[model samples]
Target: MMGSVAQLWRHPIKSHGREALEAVTLSVGQCMPLDRHWAVTHEASRFDGTGWVSCQNFMIGARTPGLAGLWARVDEEARRVTLTHRDLGELTFAPDDPAEAARFLDWIAPLCPENRARPSAVVSVQGRGMTDSDFPSISVMNLSSHRAVAQKLGRDIEPERWRGNIWLDGLGPWEEFEWIGKTIRIGSASLHVRKRITRCLHTAANPITGKRDTATLDALEVGWGHCDFGVYCEVIDGGDIRLGDKSEVL
Candidate 1:
């Protein structure tokens, strides 16, 4: 069976917002370009600039639900990020400067739970994309599986809950699991399937509202007996991936 890229996304700032892309240049040993290259570190969280850190240190949707509603765009050349929210309107800031981190926090402070650490600073490593997986990763999801979950829930769910880098259509529900330990040729790029992506509380939050409206983990448990939805892939060969590009299990 064959699948085709349905959408491409890059989150310039980790857990802050999502940027929809028509095409992206992916490379071996890296996540999507400009994806998760910067993150807002919370107070008391220890994430040094030297290596990959766990997502818990960052202000993500799971911890700050309002962040799920954020829509962002990035100008890589300009190193500028713009985020929009229905409640917050829009704000643009440079993530690299120490002076701008406080403003970024001010914009997001409304969403922070009182118990959670307050946003303190923005952190980044120029060449490495901080990902959920311990190693560098590109998240991929099957659209058919998303629909199947929606069928189980009897309503539609947003793909943003999964926060994937690649969305593929024309594959069976849960068909991506079979691709584990295999190589996938997507457009001009190749990726090695690393593992099934586990579900998290973030899945229950609406992408537009950030409210815990869906029972995705529950739906997965009832329908599939596991809390897994997507797959993580490691880029093996670098190239451009465009919308509607062929995605093949090689």
Candidate 2:
């Protein structure tokens, strides 16, 4: 066993908020259920929600760091999400409803910078999640790697800053990078590690404060000569993955 699953997270709305899960059912050729199921497009975005589009087309944390502070709870059956933030309190709404979408835009307006493009609409494509990778992918992170970064920075770093889907413990620092081009089994699911997930400005923001408090990118570069924190994997076999499940290279 390479490690055990330590944490699982999902962003119901792309770059908007994060939700914690104890277990999730993975499906072949698909992202985690309801992960990035909806994205808020900006005024300058050309995405009409017809299909998968690049992350740059949406209002994201890299643009507005305050968005990092939002916490989310999802109701998969109702297709509804309740987002909470220190500043905004809470909002419960269905992303697919036009009225709720409009309300969400209003609720989130304070978090967005006035200088940047404002969020225009909430959009989603049928059967597709808005992952950063072109292909549907799940982000896997190593707890040891996270600690390495924190040690370099001389501060405790929150894993949420990376916005990873699954986090594993018991791996060596930077060991996950070697998993590329390999298949890994977590619980009953098998996933093919495709590529390293390069770091972005979004990771510099503190998930609790929603403010830039650390030079995460600089630390990664200065220490390791690269600014990558995790690996992107595509599910090859579908099954249930839960916290504490054994993870191993296949």
Candidate 3:
């Protein structure tokens, strides 16, 4: 069965929030443009903006699930990010500015878990998306798979937990894994499925409340015996891929 695009998301600031896009232009050898464009570095982090560092070097939802409650809007043309939360209201600034970074740190201090280290600043690397994979990746998730997971949990599972770059519909649960090492066409772009995305504690966080209210990992482990939910693909051919676009395994 052919899957069609259902949603697309980009996280301009890692772990802090998400932004939805109606359409996106995928480029060869890169993830969704402006996705993971910046990350919050902690005081204990050694990431120097030189190359990709382990996710542990940055503030992430796995460590502080409450970060999920934060929402962000990115103005690429202006290089600004607007962060909003139920408690914090809204904050707008350019991530690279030291003053802005300092302000962001202040706004999130209370939200930071006591066990984790303190946030220092927001930083970025040019041309590269700070992805879980060392290689640039676009995450694809099946809506049906989400439904299956929801069924396992006996409740509705918000798609935001996956933090995927693209979401598709009409495929069987976890069927995208079968396309590994194969090509897939989405709109005018093509992607080569490479790896299955391992589930993490981040999925346990509620996007609305940013609390660890769900047992996503436990459900996946009990139902599937493994914690995997999505597929990672490298863009092979670059073009526009929009919401409701056609996706076909090749």
CA-only RMSD, every prediction = 0.9, 0.7, 0.8
- Stronger candidate by TM-score (1 vs 3): 3
Runs of candidate 1 exceeding 4 Å displacement: none
Estimate TM-scores for all models: 0.98, 0.99, 0.98
Go through the candidates in order and give the clash count of each.
0, 0, 0
**Each prediction's whole-model lDDT (CA):** 0.90, 0.94, 0.91
Model 2 gets an lDDT of 0.94
Residue 60's lDDT in candidate 3 = 93
- Give the per-residue lDDT digits (tens) of candidate 2, residues 1-250: 3799999999999998999999999999999999998999999999975789899999999999999999999988998999999989999999999999999999999999989999999999898799999999999999999999999999898999999999999999999999999999999999999999987999999898899989999999999999898999999999999999999998
Ranking by lDDT: 2, 3, 1
Query: 2 or 3, which is superior by lDDT?
Result: 2
Give the RMSD in angstroms, all C-alphas superposed, for model 1: 0.9
Ten contiguous residues with the weakest lDDT in model 3: 121-130
